[model samples]
Target: MVLAAPLAPAAPASRAPAAAPASVGGVSAAEWTIRWWRWTRSFPDGLEPYLDRDGRRCAMGQDDDGPVWFLAGTDGRFDARRRCRVPAGKHLLVPVINMYFHGPRLGENAMSCAQVKRRAAVNNDYLVSAVVLLDGKPLARPERLISRCFDPQAERDDAGPDDRRGVVRAAADGYWLLLPPLAPGPHRLSVGANYGNPDDPDYGRMLQNFEYELQVGDPAI
Candidate 1:
């Protein structure tokens, strides 16, 4: 009987009202939007031997074209209207050393099936096998193709190196085996092409093989 009259029904516990959404500059929360932009550069020159000041053969000028692949997402898909452009006066060098599909256009690094098919018609006699390496370690042996994205061809330099030590190939698709996770430091990439016919005018050669000093972890483009 000493229960203090059942605590007066717990006094009907009070509750707080929900907060309204935030707004910016008189715009409603639902109408607010954000915009971003990026700039990049690329290189067309292949890595090859060059003469130094002392007239000796040496490899130099190894640098990367700024950010190559740019991925953007709002939820997870790309937002096309929020686009970016390359900044003016920005000259990008070859940042990563890997076999890339290059077309006639300056910034046309990735090629389409039609473009590769046309090129294959002229240079169809040989194949190029690329054994990609990062920090002197093997990554993948992506097969090189003729103009066709999936038509695998023979090597351009068969007798030069037997170990497949520097071989690079193109895939049937217009994609190259890209070296992965290049650190922010000095790095070197070597390629060996097996051109099946030495006397053929379309014989392949390891053109771009050099080291580049990269500034990794930089903000994305």
Candidate 2:
């Protein structure tokens, strides 16, 4: 993987655009849903992802000030760095690493939290790679925070309001990359992935690469 030159992301637009559409590059999220019906209904929640008209991918849920931007590619196409603010302490890092496929389809493909680290990584053509630097140093990889990564429809009936707090959007990129509680300080997170393969005769699409600058200290409002 090529190391992207460090850069800062632009501030988010004042007007919040609606959620991502069904197409990334040229692949249609809608068509993907119909073709992969068994899994699409529940995973990536069958919803379209956000896209940039100029062929650029933006971070989902991330604010120029802080949090995260959803649905960006993981192939380093997104060379700009992003900013995210979070309260000091333990928090999960949920990232969407691929551009072509969505994941964590519970019940159907054995997508339970028990399998995310292994199954979710390879199944459904999903690929994810991430690097987290806290206070300029790498921290130990935390346990996979799977249960917290979820969307509606596949939502467990027994889940309460508390469990729903961590609910991710219904898109293909809605998988979690666990990060242990962060110390009160500034940090950097780099993520990369290949959605599938563009040259393959069958099943080909774009990929993703994203970076984030985090300020973890302030308390969650």
lDDT of each: 0.26, 0.36
- Candidate 2 ranges with C-alpha deviation above 4 Å: 1-80, 96-156, 159-175, 196-205
Summed backbone clashes in each candidate are 36, 26
lDDT for each residue of candidate 2 in 21-131, tens digit (9 for 90 to 100): 334335344322222222223335323222232212222323334222222233334444555556654333334332222343534543434333233333233222333
* True-vs-predicted CA distance for residue 164, candidate 2, Å: 19
Distance from true location, Cα of 63 in model 1, Å: 16
Which candidate number has the best TM-score?
Answer: 2
Worst ten in a row by lDDT for model 2:
3-12
lDDT of 1 by residue, 136-193 (tens): 5443443232222221222232433221222222222221332223444344333222
